[model samples]
Target: MNHGETAYGLWSLVALNSTVFILFAFSFFKPATARDWRSFGAFSAFIVALFVEMYGFPLTIYLMSGWLATRFPGLDLLTHDSGHLWSTLLGETGDPHFGVLHIASYVFLGYGFYLLSSAWHVLYHAQRQHSLATTGPYARVRHPQYLAFVLILLGFLLQWPTLLTLLMFPVLLVMYRRLAITEEKNMHKQFGETYDAYAQSIPRFIPRLGKARLTADAEPKK
Candidate 1:
């Protein structure tokens, strides 16, 4: 297929892409509680909105068309590559997919999904046994699931930056933070000192640098 072709208006692609990603996340998360579903729902909305603009419509490009045309006069606004705003804005000349930011986005996305899946595994078993989750990614951060969502969102932002998604990013961050706080409150009530000790050691969103990793046996037992 011609690489420069306008590929928008493909709603099937939007649906397919959204379904695949949502299902992938759902399978990993297996959200059982209302709060879990709410978090997943918001993430689903973000994914759908992203894919809609990416494949179904080009609202961001259209909104910036005038400025983009004026700034990069020779650019073909209808071409798919033009939608890669970062490359255009950064004055990169090769295929946008092969650009540094795109490659880095893959890394972020891959690692984010891996973290999500790993955290879910630990959390699932913990929930089944009615214990605190302090293994895998949870050992590094108190809210690995929230951190995973943020990482995935960041990966997408690095790849395709739409105005709507960009605006939604901070809103989602704040929402996740609130949800994390609520989750912590519930955990504290349930596990008491165990949860408190875990929270004290691990950071909320970011992990500490150069900390020695704890073995499974060394982690707090439920």
Candidate 2:
């Protein structure tokens, strides 16, 4: 294996990538509460873990080296292209960055950040008015922020599947779900029938197709 082709041990790249993504997500999500911080913190950890393996050290690759060599002897596991395991496993030739899974990962990441920004805008306004967020992306789902985080995580997984991130993904999902549920309970207590009505008409995560039922407060002002 050409030592020049080996992609790991770039600690600078790992730190740079992690900071860029974490800060980007932070600018959009803007965590305010303890729960928000906890969720954001977990997401940040996932990002750091992903980039760490991506540049600093390929622990997943190292661990699976024996099996990988046996399975695909021609493969150069130390090279960056080999890190795109989905492409390698699927027998995709040429640039892994241009592969189908990689392309789809971009879609997920783009939409995820978009959703996060949109959700934060609506949520920030609602918090200012001391009201429930049932407008914009919130009209589609009660927890757009959580959904955005999930999408981002999935995008990273698709782009580069790591042992640690794959394991953390499901656990983070459960954590976000619990946070959403707990948030809903608080909303119910605060807004009572109004929250109930909103909750009844609008689903929590998976958005309903077609027209979204909007309360008077949620309706855009003329």
Candidate 3:
């Protein structure tokens, strides 16, 4: 595509992509609590901001146009391909979508969504039974859903490093962390020793290197 056919002013694509991803996440997340809604709302705002710069307007590119032109002479600033800042910065050629970081972004996004879905499933069933969620992704990490959100945000950063989204990333991390701590406190109150034992065994956000011994059926040792 020519410069005229490239980034900026494609509001339709922006809206379409944003809607699809937000709906996809909403279906998986099914936010019920105020905290849940807050997290999801923040994520949704990030998505919309990302696509807005991605398709609606190339704000980052426009802001950096002079420096980018001086640094990488003859590069087409208007093209969508040029928006893949990681690929351009890394000096990778050809299609940016097929670049290493781009491919890695896909991996992160796919796995992130998968984790979101799986975590929600386990949490839903556990909530229904009023039991601690220790199955599936929860068996590995205490906050799989929050971890999934981080991964997804990282995936976007890899794909398109916009100024706004990059700034929002660390803020979102802190928010998720605080939310996880609050959730853990509530869980401890409700499940008492069971949650304590589970929390002791499983890391809050990261999984242990080895296989997790904890399972849904495993009884917490008194």
Candidate 4:
């Protein structure tokens, strides 16, 4: 470790970070179904793998030692900052954690958690009522929760760029997509035309921004 980077020989920090993130995510998700468990379990595994390499060990750094040393000589490959692969690859000067991408990563993380919480609330009530979820976050995007997870994962990747996380990212994305399709099939079977119309009106991943705002006078008199 160097002045620009923190030391990563501590085992406690690694365990703490991994536990905090995994537990925090589990709290918000409250996953129950087999599919949900698989998704949540996979997400937890990714998080664990990420922190493991980031603090406890540096497998990717070790694996790519030859190439990294050849490409950028005098690199502090063992430094925690060097684990930020984007900074090294881009030859970004100054602290990698303070770079634009790192700052933007925080934005993605915040928005993703926000979306996850909000979407979960709406989905919970809709599921309880056995009705279509077409309000709140659901009004703008069909799969806001999954998109939220994707954003969160992307944020982590941007900040850390570990090989394990990078590989897990695409796999989780495909899983989420398939899960969304299965969810849609169930919704279509239940709501039929109503769900079809709602699905058609709303985008799957991208939001419609402000188009979902309700007009105060649009509702019929009680």
How high a TM-score does candidate 2 get?
0.95
The residue-by-residue lDDT of candidate 1 on 117-188, one tens digit each, is: 999999989888988888788888888888988999999999999999999999999999999999999999
Worst lDDT 10-window in candidate 1: 212-221
- Evaluated at residue 26, the lDDT of candidate 2 is 97
Tell me the tens digit of each residue's lDDT in model 3 across 1-222. Answer: 235457788999999999999999999889999999999999999999999999988889989999999999989988889999999989999999999999999999999999999999998988888788887998899999999999999999999999999999999999999999999999989988778888888899999998787634345332
The 10 consecutive residues of candidate 3 with the worst lDDT sum are: 213-222
What's the CA error at residue 163 for candidate 1, in Å? 0.5
User: Which parts of model 2 have CA positions greater than 4 angstroms off?
Assistant: 215-222
lDDT of candidates 1 onward, in order? 0.89, 0.91, 0.91, 0.84
Model 4 lDDT-worst window of ten: 213-222
Q: What is the C-alpha RMSD of each candidate to the true structure, in Å?
A: 2.7, 1.8, 2.4, 3.4
List clashing residue pairs in candidate 3. Answer: none
> lDDT per residue, candidate 2, 7-87, as tens digits?
899999999999999999999888888998999999999999999999989999999999999999878898999999999
TM-score-superior candidate, 1 or 4: 1
Residue 40 Cα positional deviation in candidate 4, in Å, after optimal superposition:
0.9
